[model samples]
Target: MKRIGAFLLTGAFLLMNVAVMAQCSLCTKTAQQLGEGPAKGLNNGILMLALTPLVIIGFLAFRWWKSNKEA
Candidate 1:
């Protein structure tokens, strides 16, 4: 039951679609001037930068959970 609930929650999170504006006012203006290609590049760059810390934290949390489960 617990495992099923966890899987369902994870599945729900994975299925969720959300748009994030990872741009500041200055960045938005810069992208607008630079055009679509640069705008996409800027957005991807920002997302990658933001994702690094999250990846690390998620990894740490998974490891902690696994260790606790073993105990």
Candidate 2:
């Protein structure tokens, strides 16, 4: 039913968020291991900032498309 679909969607979103967090942690660890703590953090910050727009756009597009789809 609709409830099940909604639950699945929420779960999928949660899982995706967790995956991204895991990847971010891995990136941080790799940078630290390479002896570039400060540099790595800055690099990550810069990367995130640079990708912010793309992420936003993608999310917006996805939401727009999803909302328009018929059940």
Candidate 3:
């Protein structure tokens, strides 16, 4: 039951997509003026930044699970 609940919670979080408003008006304006290349780079950078913490958490969770399973 606990595993099922955790699976559902994780699935919900993964499926959720919230619209993120631009944080800096000046930066946004500059990116737009610079054209598609800079805009794409900015988007990729944001995604990489956002994924870093999730990746760390996931690795820690996997380690914890493995340790608990062994014991």
Candidate 4:
């Protein structure tokens, strides 16, 4: 039991270290090369990519509710 607990703790610590140590590469590049037409495209793409999942999830949730209500 103690071995399993130690293994889990090690995994958690490694994951935390990786999360904190990594830099946002896209953000760094964007900061370096500010104010250009392609940057605007990148910003717009990120916004659309972020919103796409929300829109899809919302649609699926509404469909799920509607189908469950009729049953």
Candidate 5:
């Protein structure tokens, strides 16, 4: 299970270079003005920010599940 999770994480990281257009209207307009490179950076920043919470929740859930399974 741990190995599978690690493999999936590695794959996701490797594939993360593909453009993510996850910007609000204002951010989208700002990124458009900033051009491609900056826009991509902005998108990646947003994506990471969004994923941080999900990753934390997933880790906590995994721990909880593991403890329950052990019990």
Candidate 6:
């Protein structure tokens, strides 16, 4: 039951999407002026930046879970 609850919670978190406007006015203006290539690069950079902390936290959580399971 605890495992099922945890799975549902994690699934809900993974599926939830929040619309966030992370760009400042200057950045938006620059991207608009730079054409498609630069705009794509900027977007990829933003995604990498955004995902880095989540990836780190997920890794740490996985490690903690493994350790707890062994005990």
> lDDT values of the candidates?
0.92, 0.70, 0.81, 0.70, 0.92, 0.84
- TM-score of each prediction: 0.70, 0.39, 0.54, 0.49, 0.70, 0.57
Residues 1-71, model 4: lDDT tens digits: 99799889969975773322122587648745875666656666666777789889989998998999999
What pairs collide in candidate 5? none
Q: List the residue pairs that clash in candidate 6.
A: none
* RMSD (CA, Å), each prediction: 2.2, 6.3, 3.5, 10.8, 3.1, 3.5
Clashing pairs in 3: none
Q: After superposition on all CA atoms, how large is the RMSD of candidate 6?
A: 3.5
Residue pairs clashing, model 2: none
lDDT for each residue of candidate 2 in 1-71, tens digit (9 for 90 to 100) = 99799899979976773323323666667666777566556566766887889789989998998888954
- On lDDT, the stronger of 4 and 6 is 6
**Tens digit of lDDT per residue, candidate 6, span 1-71?**
99899999989987988645456789779988999789768867887798999899999999998999999
Write the residue-wise lDDT of candidate 3 on 1-68 in tens digits.
99899999999987988645443678678779989798767766777788899899999999998999
The 10-residue segment with the lowest total lDDT in model 6: 18-27
Report the C-alpha displacement of residue 13, candidate 1, in angstroms: 4.9
Give the candidate number with the greatest TM-score.
1
Candidate 1 Cα outliers beyond 4 Å, as residue runs: 1-19
Of candidates 6 and 1, the better by lDDT: 1
Cα lDDT tens digits, model 5, 1-71, are: 99899999989998885655789999999999999999989988999999999999999999998999999
Give Cα distance to truth, residue 16, candidate 6, Å: 15
Error of 3 at 62 (Å): 0.3
**Candidate 3's TM-score:** 0.54
TM-score of 2: 0.39
